[model samples]
Target: MSVGDDIPDFPATGVETIAAAARWAGEHFATVPAVVDGDLRWTFREYIDRAESIAAGLVAIGVQNGDRVGIWAPNSADFAATVLGIQLAGAALVPLNTRFTVTETGDICARASVRAVFTVDGFLGRPYADEFAAHRQERPEILADGASIITFDGTGEDSIELLIARGTDEHRREVDARVASLRPEDTGIVLFTSGTTGRPKGIRLGHGQLLRAYWQWGGILGLEASDRVLLSNPFFHAFGLLVGLLAALVRGTTVYPLAVFNSADALRIIEAERITFYPAPPTVFQTMLQDPALESTDTSSLRIAVTGATSIPPSLIRAMHDVLGIERVFSPYGLTEATGVATLTRFGDSVETIAQTAGRPVPGVEVVILRPDESQADAGEIGEICVRGYNTLVSYLDDDTPLTDERGWMHTGDLGTFDEAGNLRVTGRLKDMFIVGGFNVYPAEVEAVLSSQPGVSAVAVVGIPDERLGEVGAAFIIPKTGASVDEAELVASAGERLANYKRPRRYFFVDAFPVNASGKVLKHELVASVTAAPAAG
Candidate 1:
């Protein structure tokens, strides 16, 4: 059935609050498993019950309505519970990336005016609490006056265990009143963008926008109770928090979150839990496929695979089906501003179609390709992709950057085109496109061509300054294990596959590319690495 005809019926869910959604999910799917972290498992009822306790605890500690509360930890059961607790306490959630440093976290926390932060003492051998305190001391304004820091894992009285112990019947009653008082239009979350490019921007989004958007996602994806999802995406990002975790609440899917992605451990969980659905960046799948344990592990239980965060390679889609045993693979595209989903490939789309395009706009979102003059571009014409919908964020917190023009159309700053079927083909970022001798060179196009090469595992193309041409493409190649490529031959292949101006002038053979917390390639860092080297004529 076409997406237009098969939309699933969802609950009226009038409140639009995360707390309300959790209550609905718990009432309906109470006995079903909601989350499984390590050996700990929580039914939907248990999950909501814990969230209520946390909410009461937060309220007892003075977290008021609309106050910003930051959660700084990796993906875990605690992370999931705190997200609901913050909202249930009538505060806006601010999820800090686990990969962020003390200074970066402080910058965002200050900008968001976070009054309280829930974090860990350390994770993966780094002391976050100590580092954050030191940074806050240095920049006294980094935290709001009298802000409280609560640790998720510690022996101190301020730990999560002690806080929950402090929750009384009176506090719980206050929590109930707080949740009831929240309006659909209330600010629900403030997610800061990854600061790979510059200082991160805090995106303020309303509960209504987030809940409505994820409902569409759950409907379009055909998610249902009993579908076990392995979420490798970090909960800090919208993809993980909104789509991965919150979507589960909407659909009642059992979610297993990996704190940090480990291919071998992921394989073990897939085998042990009989995981049916998994979604992550293409690199995560690549790493899993390359792992030696995958040959011996049982992954046939996987039914659906969702990928995005970078361009999808046609070959990888084939591998996901043939090599990884996934039945249906989907590629979706969106940014933080759009509430994490705008376009999604249909369930039964042809592999080639899914590989070639990012898919049609999800219901409610209107996508248009417009030229620089704001004129609509014809089909298959390369232009900036714009979106308008209820999913578009309200605004960037603390920055005057306009999110939309008068007509509510958000210029995505991404260059793309629509096929005859209205599927989106994102070519590259407008800021990332460079001019080579008068010709426009899109790095994504060049990278796409090179990615099909036999020995290449992953590739990133960045435009570097040239003495002759204004800018030229530099290719960074991470070759497949036990495989080798001749640079001249690879360059010759690129020459045949692309136009002269789009071809790379230099190739850097590397083990890996520098990526942000979200697994997006840091092109600026690649450019810096290329510029530090001698010019390749």
Candidate 2:
């Protein structure tokens, strides 16, 4: 909970946020290595200059401030610059995960009113240019079934290569002028989240919210002129877009984006670049720690290794510190609405607590625990974590309605308990709850228990609609590396510890869980795939 000062004012706009950082870096650390996009490299000044070009290009394309520009691409310098460029043009960027199927991307694109799409011709050693174009060409219901398509390189059915190529250097300058007129409260992003409402809701964040989060921790995150921040996650995520990209400017830090994450290579880059700051997700940490190269590399330069996006296992936190030699493993709890970080744990807290708790609210942020009746809950009691803060988003896109109830509090669906020390510990998602034989069972509880199993690497608990119990608990498990477990034995052990009703009725072991760019388990995707499996496949 250690913090330095009051939350500062959000730099009126997102472009201003990055521009400020570029100005600082240009003066103080011009020679320092910044971005590492595949093999392409840049200094802090060079990175900002590239963004200026893209900003101008976006403006020439008829994009206006608050206009949505959807992007579907991997983690690369182009993707990073486009985020800043879109902001610079006074436009909001809607970043879509490249990992999603065409159907998923198509649905999101349609909802956001995306005027233009930016995507790679192909990636991950797979040809997907056609998939990107199918959103405009085919019926979504029919396209959900895998359809082979071609690239939009003027073929018009497959990709946006033409659209991007069409922008000239002159266009780039015009776009920059357009970007210069943006307002702080304008929609900066339309982040899609899979909520229980059946479809993903566009979680909107304005320029003010985006800039405020970066400024709140600018000085604290050591975003000083000479520092280098490592960004390895996909650009589609707020974690990657704002914290790693936009935060670079306001906080005065240079960025080094890893297009692909290889733990061995990550160690090499840390040593080679002498990177001082990094914000990694749980999956990224898991990958690096498992690599044997960590033992041989001198990764002592990194000042902090922040982890978030999902609940990090305690073992992962300990391994990052005791094994991988990371200086700190802090977890900050936030959603798309909060502009990224709303709660943060200090760097040196014990792993057990750091891994389990989401820590205290950031300065000037107020968090409340609400009962079912909407009254505030006492400390140590389980309740919804409601937040009210300056960093909070203005509203959802196309809808200016308030997210709070009649009482004026954002009812974050996350369930948590505040300890006597006033730290927030997120337990589970409320929409994921199910009534098993008249008893309510939360998937996180069962998943945590199963994750502790010797042969289990990861597990996801879900409730399948059933005729008898109304809903039945199901689990998809990933066995530990080079290990195996019997489904019957695993189910029996779980049944022994819990009331009979809460025990999982079926178990299926899979090689991996399907996740989005943010490392969040796509529960709906898992449930859909599992539900379609005939008797657990």
- For this target, which candidate reaches the highest lDDT against the unseen true structure? 1
- Where does candidate 1 stray beyond 4 Å? 398-402, 535-537
Q: Residue 183 deviation, candidate 2, in Å?
A: 2.0
Residue 229 in candidate 2, Cα distance off native in Å = 3.1
Return the TM-score for candidate 2, rounded to 2 decimals: 0.83
Question: Which parts of model 2 have CA positions greater than 4 angstroms off?
Answer: 4-31, 126-180, 195-197, 218-223, 309-311, 436-438, 453-455, 464-475, 484-508, 514-519, 522-537
Instruction: Give the 10-residue window scoring lowest on summed lDDT in candidate 2.
Output: 144-153
lDDT of 2 by residue, 212-263 (tens): 6777766445456677778886678777777777777665566777767777
What global local distance difference test value does model 1 have? 0.85
Write one digit per residue (lDDT tens) for candidate 1, span 258-325. Answer: 98889988999999999988988888898898899999999999988878744667888999999889
Candidate 2 achieves a global lDDT of 0.69
